[model samples]
Target: MQDRMTPAERLAAVLMGQKPDRVPVNPFILGFAAKIVNLPIGDLYADPRKSFRAQLLCAEMYGYDATPMYAYASFGAWEFGGEVGMPYEPGQSAPYIIRHPVESPEDVDKLEVPDPRKAGSIPIAMEIAKLCYENKMPVVFQAGEVLTTAANIAEPARLLRWMIRAPDVVHKLNKKVAEFFIAVAEYFTSTFGADKCMAFTGGPVESNKLINPRQFGEFVFPYMKQIHSKVLGMGVHVILEHPCSDQNANLPYYVQLRKELGWNGKYIWAFGPETPLEKQIECFGEHDIIMGNVDPPSFQFKSFEDVLALCKDNIERGIKNPSGYILGVGCELPPLAPPINVYALMKAAREYGRYQ
Candidate 1:
């Protein structure tokens, strides 16, 4: 029960389904903290040192179980001229098109995979990984899943349309994207030790609310399995399949996939406020780690009391499996979330996250 557990010890304990001294909190810091600390968001995708300093500072100030030095945007499509727009605010993560470049079946044959080491923002991300590793902080490297990457390349709306209009093209594109991401994962893991690398799949590919079980099986599941298998083959722990919508209906599919792929339930299936904790815990059971559910809006617009209440509710939902839970905002923390509210989340985690 030592408070000074090594990062490896803490993470290994969690992955092994054992209680550590307390639950781990691994929230991605953005918005106000970046500005208050004077870390510019624009530099995050371009400068590894700036990103590393900001992330390390947040980890030091807030006390997280792990440090994740993530590029603010996906490197592949961004480098290939994938319709990305400026941030909603001056110091926020840049927003990309709901649509993509590979709009038609013909576009699939023309899509080129960007090399991770040479791509637009990937070198910076890799450099950040080196920085985090040099600092001796465990780093989780976030990457987009095949579907997300495909969506990024062809735009989400176009890809969704292609699912029904041109399923074969969608399948081909996803396979290519999956393979590309695997290479990226391999490069980073090899460069910065597998133990320090955690692969992140962004967006809601597994959500039944967004895509049906049939669609997921055809378009999403295979690519996810490929990505997860590739990462595991490289001896890296693939942490979160960040599906923000309702995954209850497809939880069985994920559970079955994990069994087939030999993934221990220790891998995370992160959710947001939209995913009720009762449903998530009931569907996935005690072995699974639930990473999110605290509404970002509360942190952005609500009172500290309200934020505390949200934290308490999320924690209470996983009280029976404290070691299998992480305290975090439903998605990226809003750029304007109050520092006190952020601290409130950490305090609640400390108070309620104790392993009895």
Candidate 2:
């Protein structure tokens, strides 16, 4: 462990299968910090300065290695002129989905990929990335994955119905969505440069707990593979896939996909609490970094001591293999999670996280 190293260097070292000063800590910021600072979510999405300030706050306050510039809600569909209705509670957090477009197979043909630089929330994201680059802060920009975007466009429930009732149409829609995702990535890379931004972060929410692995392979994997290959080709450092469920069964397939695409294991296969760590280690190997198994609910509701103990145990387990692990919540840290617990988790990673 080097005594003096910059956050970006530490992160880059870890991703390159090398030991850093300590395990890099990355926490997902879900635009709540903007609200905390009395900035509306919409405004945060619209103004790069506001978003950058909020991200800097999270990094400075929480000691996070990277600042995630995530959009307020899902934006992939919105680019295609599809309507998305997000319901927010007054005092409580947790976004509720109220509406989406793409009701029938005919709807797929109507979809046209929008210019990411000019469309929906993407311009705002690009601006924020530019600001982060100017400030020399490592930024992790979130681009919705193909399958996740497809699900977003055709509301989850409606897509599920289509999977069962109209499989062919579902495949066509997914392909169209995947193509759009590739275009978006190309546009972002062209604007921000592949090295300036961290890998794309978004969920493949259509998998496992929501649908089986067969459906995942059919609707999710192909598109994800396309996006992953493109990003890898551009020499991107990481492509963190967020699938917040027990995706152990899909591990082998993910590994195979990486092999087929000739991807370095630096990219993350971020999993939920239900994923077995031992199995992930065995399947993905010692050099492949894994992120998150800590359940967000536990950290939010449990005692700090309990959270510390869990984090300590996880760090110990991770170092058993060495240099290829990160400690983070399975999903975004709940907005209400105790700041002390978050600090404790980071502290545990610093003290107990080591490569030998």
Candidate topping TM-score: 2
Clashing residue pairs, candidate 2?
none
TM-score of each: 0.88, 0.89
True-structure lDDT of candidate 2: 0.68
- Model 2 misplacement above 4 A: 1-4, 35-46, 71-73, 85-89, 92-98, 354-356
Residue 106's C-alpha lDDT in candidate 2?
88
Task: Give the per-residue lDDT of model 1 (tens digit) for 1-356.
Answer: 23556545666677777777766776656544465477666554455677677766776777766575664433346645465553545545654454356766887888777676776566767787787788776556655666666776776778888899888888888877877788788888888778777777666544676688778778877787777776777888656767756666666667776777765535776776777777767656555776757887778788988888888788777656543776777777776677888887778877877776
Off by over 4 Å in 1: 1-12, 71-76, 79-92, 95-100, 205-209
Compose the digit string of candidate 2's lDDT tens values, residues 296-349.
Answer: 777678998999888888777665544377777777677667667777777777
